[model samples]
Target chain A: MEERIEISILLDFYGELLTDKQKNIMKMYYNEDLSLAEIAELNNISRQAIHDLIKRCYKQLLAYEEKLNLMKKSFEQKKIKNEILEELHKLNHQSEAVIDEQRIKKIEQLVKTAM
Target chain B: MEERIEISILLDFYGELLTDKQKNIMKMYYNEDLSLAEIAELNNISRQAIHDLIKRCYKQLLAYEEKLNLMKKSFEQKKIKNEILEELHKLNHQSEAVIDEQRIKKIEQLVKTAM
Candidate 1:
């Protein structure tokens, strides 16, 4: 599960850097949860070839992350967003009548926009 | 000024994909405000070669932005952050007695973290 999450995060940040074939294979194997044999059959390649391609894609994604740190920055942004939301929630509770409705709505908008 | 801003945004998003030489040339030309002749002399290359390298780097940066839209997303995030800050300021004004101190600090923290 942790590995899947990590791959999804990397794919989100660097998938465009990959070739179309590598992107498709990664989406199938990781996002669609397809087995290597299934992807190999679908793409008319050997299972071992599919395995190697996936490994190469993983290495490329990791290399991009290491160099750019986009995934790390994105995760930090998310953490800050959550912290802001929590603070907003506290403010909402402090003054429910005066600050809840519009402030909460704006906070929701900010969260959605950030995401 | 607008062109410089655009290039800076593009550089922030895709500069990591460039070669070290390309990166150095771009930084000297755009960020450091160096002339082509100056850069060429400093690097022991022809002025025409420096110009060509700068153009190639610009093309690669644009291609990356076209493929990934990371720069666009980043701008949108900044706009959202501004909107959130404005909303927080409004909230702060509405309830200075109750919400100003901690909420303002938290909002400042969020803005800095997001940046």
Candidate 2:
């Protein structure tokens, strides 16, 4: 993934663990693509302070990812969903020609609930 | 749920995060139904120490559940699976004579994955 997407993913998963001020700084810098000086000026902090805070937040987010691995589990689940979809397609296209709309819908709903 | 079952459920969801000794003590007490005295004797620790450690471990497990809610989620998922099964039963028994074995198995697999 791109660095920008990776940071946002980490933030999406664990940003609540950050303080409001720290989280705001991170959103501005990472999500908003603001320069350190721009963020520092907006928050009334030194550019160096903003730089250091972002550095800390980046490390903290990585640490949370390392410990929790919720991000990894999410990707694994997507893979499982794809695999299930393939199985459903095969089941529908089998030689028996037993494919029906109601059945497919019910099966799709079940897959929706599980994944 | 019974107290014993609840503890085991919490332990099952969050036990890996506990220290090996803490987890072992928990399993012995909750799953094995061992008294504090027996556990203390086994670990060569005082009964009071064992009691305190168990108290701490219980609090820690509850904290993990509070943060993660994985135990709560598992129960909720079980309920959803039951609901899906009910829907599936209705769909199978509906006007169409579509209660086939291969289709049912494939639909079951989808429910298995999502839940």
DockQ of each: 0.21, 0.15
TM-score of chain A of each: 0.77, 0.77
Candidate 2 per-residue lDDT over residues B6-84, each given as its tens digit: 9898888777667889999999999999999999999999999989988998998888777667678667766656655
Task: State the C-alpha RMSD over the true interface residues for candidate 2, after superposing those residues.
Answer: 6.7
Candidate 2: fraction of native contacts reproduced: 0.04
Candidate 2 clash pair list = A114-B114, A114-B115, A115-B114
- Per-residue CA lDDT of model 1 for A40-83, tens digit only, reads 99999999999999999999999898888987877766775776
TM for every model, in the order presented, reads 0.78, 0.63
> True contacts preserved, each candidate?
0.12, 0.04
* Candidate 2 segments exceeding 4 Å error: A2-4, A10-68, A82-115, B93-95, B98-115
After superposition, which runs of candidate 1 have C-alpha atoms over 4 Å from their true positions?
A: A95-115, B95-115
Q: What is the C-alpha RMSD of each candidate to the true structure, in Å?
A: 6.0, 5.8
The lDDT per prediction is: 0.77, 0.75
